[model samples]
Target: MPSIIKCLSYTLPSNVYTNEDYYSNFPDVKSVNMEKIGVKQRHVITQGQTASDLAQLAAEKLFLEHSIDRNMIDFLIVSILEHDYYTPSTACVLHGKLGLQKKCGALDFDLGCSAYVYGLGLADGVMKSMGAKNVLLLTTSVLTKTFHPKDRNSHFVFGDAGTATLLTLSEKENLGPFVFGTDGSGFEKIIIRDGGTRNPLDKNSENELKDEFGNITSNANFAMDGIGVFNFSLKTVPTMIEELLTKASLTQNDIDLFVFHQPNKFLNETLRKKMNIPEPKFVHCLENTGNTVAGTIPIALYESIANGRLKPGMTVVLAGFGVGLSWAATIARF
Candidate 1:
């Protein structure tokens, strides 16, 4: 049995923030052309909202649009950079909120930009191993909440959103042959320093400090080595794509559309041009969504299908590289 993507749906927070808004909030922040980054505006969750809330909204939309029965879904997999709580998995919480049957399996995985691709692989493996028929894969992030309001390096780079994808067992193999890579040495390239058990919060963790860029943040806030991440992506992503193409026995031209994680306009364009992927064949959806971490790829896929860039029988390549120094690429036929 092969995993087939049945449908994709996404939800964005109601609050809108833009580069101009950042400038207004932090006048000392270095000025950068928003066009170059490919983000004019980003949606952010307002107070009282959580990633699970966004995930639930997206899942509800999927259920309504596809008329899917909650009982029929055998597994629920959630990929998120942050969860609402520390104990129970977000997937289990979602399972109860959605009124899924007690027989359903649920779990959560911590991942960043590469989450959607990884979730697809996990779903395929679980379904194949357990003979499960249906799986709901949800990817989401509320990374903005972890960034200091004055942290220019990260505050302007992330947005809040969630995506829900349905994968069902089919005779035809529409997904697989994935290539994955990890470089834990670059783990510090993007990270939150004081939240996990490794570094529990303390007085110093909440104390604000200034970075070289004049961005102020606490040890508890999200911090990113922008230059380091840029270099890592340039070095690893293209090679991963090539390896994936080789694994799938396909070439650049064979893929009808290339959907890479929407980290930023510059990095994405750079990778596309390096791979010699023509403009029409590349899909970029970060203009209004910003970098929604794990949500970027699926949201882009949803928009691609809605706009007719993706269709049944069309082959698409999905790649994601980011936090954890992790990256993955895979081929799927719609």
Candidate 2:
């Protein structure tokens, strides 16, 4: 028994887009360094859909294919910063959708890119502590729903998707020495100016945002200081990975694949260059799916396992950063 990923599944919205399509609508859109990112396309969820719907779809697939009884799941965690509603918790909504209403304890976390790794760490700790057998950790984020079409930076780069990972107890060793950290001081680097308690879409607030043409984009839209985000990400992500390797008592040579939050092609390349990490081991899926926010790591993991980039008994390093001014990394033998 391996307390590792027993089975993993992903559900990407049945829509696609290209750089040309994204850039033509907004000329100022910073060009995605497609070649470097190794993503030729990405899936985009349609309008009028919420993150919970995507998570449920993916979870259903996981259960049906694996024949997992929903009731056996003792805990269900939905890792995401964006939720269908702030009060109900996306985990509860997903539990109902999956019909795990009775035995499951559900909750949502407000983590962005780092959600998947953090979710894995959290799930592992709780499951072992409580003597549970199985835990389903699901993550979904529709970056497009919060994206303003006029916001070139995010609109061109952010795609929508959901992923589900089933973690179970093992007779062997569990995933070891996870490395996670946060820096709230730079929280504004990736800020959604409106729609939260800080700037709720209410009359008491004076929230406003304008597009490149100087027209008001919308009262509710996401905003990021791209330069600050890029600088922070490039610096923090590689260092975290190194720390994770150290904790595992391993070095860069021990990793078989490196999966990271699909932020963008430029950032990935820059980080690799600065850290001297091998190019072939760096896994990214930005072109096809853009940045799926918190969903990228698992989605990329599925792709890697499917396409033979990863195999059984291989050591994979997972790292994610962004949005909460957060970052996390972990090394797993699959």
Candidate 3:
């Protein structure tokens, strides 16, 4: 059994936060590079939206536009950094909210930027082994809630969104040959320190502290090692791409499009130049979407198809890197 991505859909809240909003709030942080990050605005969850809600919305869109029958879906895999509850998986919540069949299996996985690629691999294996026909892979992120309002290192770079990609068994496989890498040593590079079991939230966790860069954040908020992340991408992404190409027995030129995690404009452009890939062969959709963590790659894919950059039967190389210090690359035929 092989998996083919039949459709891609995404949803973002209507609330818009512009770069000027960040600048207005942190007047002292004049040196923050908004242009380099390539995001002028981002959609943010209003007061009540959760990651599951966004995922459901995206799935609804897929069902409507593609005329997919939800009752036929056999498995649901959701990738998200935050969950509505610690006990129940977000996938289960989505399954129920969408009124999916009771026979459907659901699971949630914790991952960041690399999640979409990982989800595809998981879906393919599940479809083959379980003899299932349809697997719905959902990746959602509401990272803005994790960020401290004044944390210049991460606030402007993240956005809130969710994506749904329908993977179904087909005579021809459109996905495969994934290469994955992880470096736990860099786990602290991007983390939310106070909410988990190890560092259970306390009153002290709310104490605000300012970094050398004049950014303010509390222990309960998300923090990032910007330099460490940048260096890691510079070192690992190229090698990952090369390894993926080698594993798939293909050359760089054989790929019609390269869709990597959209961390920031500068990092993505840097990776493209480093890979020696032409601008037209790469997909860049971060100008409006920002980096939506697990949702980045799928969102990029949706935009690519909409803008005519991606076409049916085209060979595409998808890669994602970040958060778990994890990276993955795979080849897919559209």
Candidate 4:
């Protein structure tokens, strides 16, 4: 018996923001069911809300439900594509918010999409040898507040939410092997063009241009080559999962549940069909919370376990891909 996912919980803002109603400002809103895309209405943060605020809410919920003694937790890891501030990691803010004093180690990892598996691996290692019995992993994506409302391509798809998962060394559970991959060359395939040191806001104005649709287009704004990302996912995800299972000496049949990142309803369905996985084993949470970046899979897992869709002793496969052109997979025994 080693470290296992003892329990997990997640939360999202109560508001829902979508381009569907802003027909005048954004003309591309369609009638398609948001659920069809793996999200119905995504939670929207209220004005002045920050990523840390959402994360705090989720962490508090998990903390209260488990009644975990904050001092017993040894490490805190925060993963986010966007943070509330450029300085002092969001995890540090969460530490102060929770008032968990004791100079517990805090780290911030800048990753998009494939972070849970990566973070879980790091947490598992820390809890085993750090003289700590528990570790807290929190992830949040507040892309909704970052993207301009006029940008229809990204506005309707991205959502804001936060999730927390507890990992601890326990005697009554099982944990599985992990497999990870990255292709930095395709990093530009899905990215936000501006706001980084490479292309700071101080750059010349002429370098930017507007699209034919009159939308101010820049490398800084979020632009995703949908077709390219889709092809990358469908072609690479199955192989990644296969290799993960192989390392664990398991197979598709050995897994009772398949929890992949909620990229989109259409893409998930396509990959599911390609992998020949039955619908019953797949977990989809796009309806209520849209694509929550790093928050998607964990939130879905938390909901499933809470609703009894996931039970103890069940074998589950977790995979995540997107942003950073990165992908990761790991098998877990629930």
Candidate 5:
């Protein structure tokens, strides 16, 4: 493993959407299962704010709070489910925003829940193949704006967030032995049907359609097939975990903590029970932030560290699963 995380930091916009606010804003909020999602409140960006803004703030906080030397960062990788533009990579935008050394390399990629794990794997690869000494990995999701106005199915489940993780090449391994999977067939289970080259936004893109349950969205908005995603997770996550454990040569009992993407309380709790993983070892951090897509795992892990739950010298398993029907898991020593 050539990558070791030096610091982790995250930021959320100021706008808070508590359950109370939801009921007040949408009288039909009861149609959405509030308890199952296990979210008390979520922070969403106000109008005109972008995911890159949160990421920039998070990265600035990372540097200032941790006393990180910006000059030493050699590569920057930004992972997002949504981007600020179609041409320029968000990483390049951040490179300019952060004022990093001109020699630094920058790139961006889009992934959903499994993004943090993918970013880590890429960081390690760059350190090994490109000789990047320091890699700045930023994961962000700004999904609130993606929901169609009347979409009850997803409008409540997602919050906006940005996370920054600084990693450096090291002699001893602190991250590695990852198992990744993709189910392109289930792509529609969670997707934004328009705005891509495959389905460019048009006048009809915003035409709202209501489902049988009265939930509404349009081709222009991001959406998810909840039951489909739930079933997909239940089917795929266990096998992925077993493979990850085997690849790392570690048993269930060997892991000190299990950090998975915070999709929802019901779905995650169901997975935990199905896997027979002990309650205390599993991390459940979605009480306040809701599902932040790519930002979930890192934000949860960072919060656990702050709360003294994921202490140093602990052996942890980090797993992320969701949109693209994608999944990834890896064992790490913290």
Candidate 6:
């Protein structure tokens, strides 16, 4: 049996950060090139909300909005950059809260921007694991929390959102021929210096450090090497797309829609130009959502469907890159 994505739903935090909000928040940073950044506004979580909170709410929306039957779900998978606890995975936590069947298998993995496509890969494995009929894949992250409060360069580029994807097992395959790549050397390109076991947090981590660009960060805050990341994407993504197309034994023209992860406007546009992809065939709906990290591609898919860009009998190419210095692409028939 092959795993097929059945449906998708996404939920954004109520709070929003507009271009005006960015200017007002940082008086010294007078202006932003709205055309270049391509983010008019971004939804963000306020208060002490965790990624797991958004995960549960998104699952609720998936069930209520899609009229899904809880008992029908045979397996559950969640991919989050953060966890509700260091021990029990968020998948088990969500399974209990959503009141799934006792026998339903559940697990969670730590992944960032490439999570959605990677989760689908995991779903394919699990579907074959036990002849599972239905699998729930949730990608959630409060990535905005990772940014330094005063880091003007990268703060506005990320937004908080959680998305749920439902996959059903079928005899015919709609998803396959995936190409995955990783370069661990670029790990620090997008990193939180301390928190994990490799470099545990301490009181010193609380002490704020200012950079040459007047940006503020700490061992506990997120910092990205913008230039390094841009060059890495430029070098990696186009090649990954080619590898995926070759693996599927198809060319770019055969693809009906090209949906890649939206990290920011400049990088996405640059990559599109490099790949020579036409504007009409490529999907770019991130003006309102910003970079939702793992949630980016799925949210784009939902909006694309709502606007009639994606329909039955369409072949869509899904690609995701970033945060593990990882990239992956696959072909899926809708």
TM-score of each predicted structure versus truth: 0.97, 0.90, 0.97, 0.91, 0.97, 0.96
lDDT of 2: 0.79
The 10 consecutive residues of candidate 3 with the worst lDDT sum are 25-34
Q: In candidate 5, which residue pairs get closer than 3 Å at backbone N, Cα or C atoms, i.e. clash? A: none
How high a TM-score does candidate 2 get? 0.90
Pairs of colliding residues, candidate 1: 313-334
lDDT of each: 0.89, 0.79, 0.89, 0.80, 0.88, 0.88
Off by over 4 Å in 1: 29-32
Candidate 2 lDDT tens digits, 1-334: 3468788888888877776676677665345443454555667778777788889988999999789888788889888766777577778877887888486678788789888999988888877776667889998888777666666556666788888999988777657678888898987777666676666686733345764545334557677777788889877887898788878889888888888888887788788778887888888666678788888899889889889898999988888898889898887778
Over the stretch 28-99, how does candidate 6's per-residue lDDT look in tens digits?
775645448788888988889999989989998999999999899989999988888887888899899999
| lDDT by residue for model 3 (165-214), tens | 99988887679799999999999998888988899999899889887767
Give the poorly placed runs of model 4, Cα more than 4 Å off. Answer: 18-28, 32-35, 203-217
lDDT of 3 at 74: 92
RMSD of each: 1.3, 2.8, 1.3, 2.5, 1.3, 1.4
Tens-digit per-residue lDDT, 288-319, candidate 1: 88999999999999999999889889999999
Q: Candidate 3, which segments miss by more than 4 Å at Cα?
A: none
Error of 2 at 319 (Å): 0.6
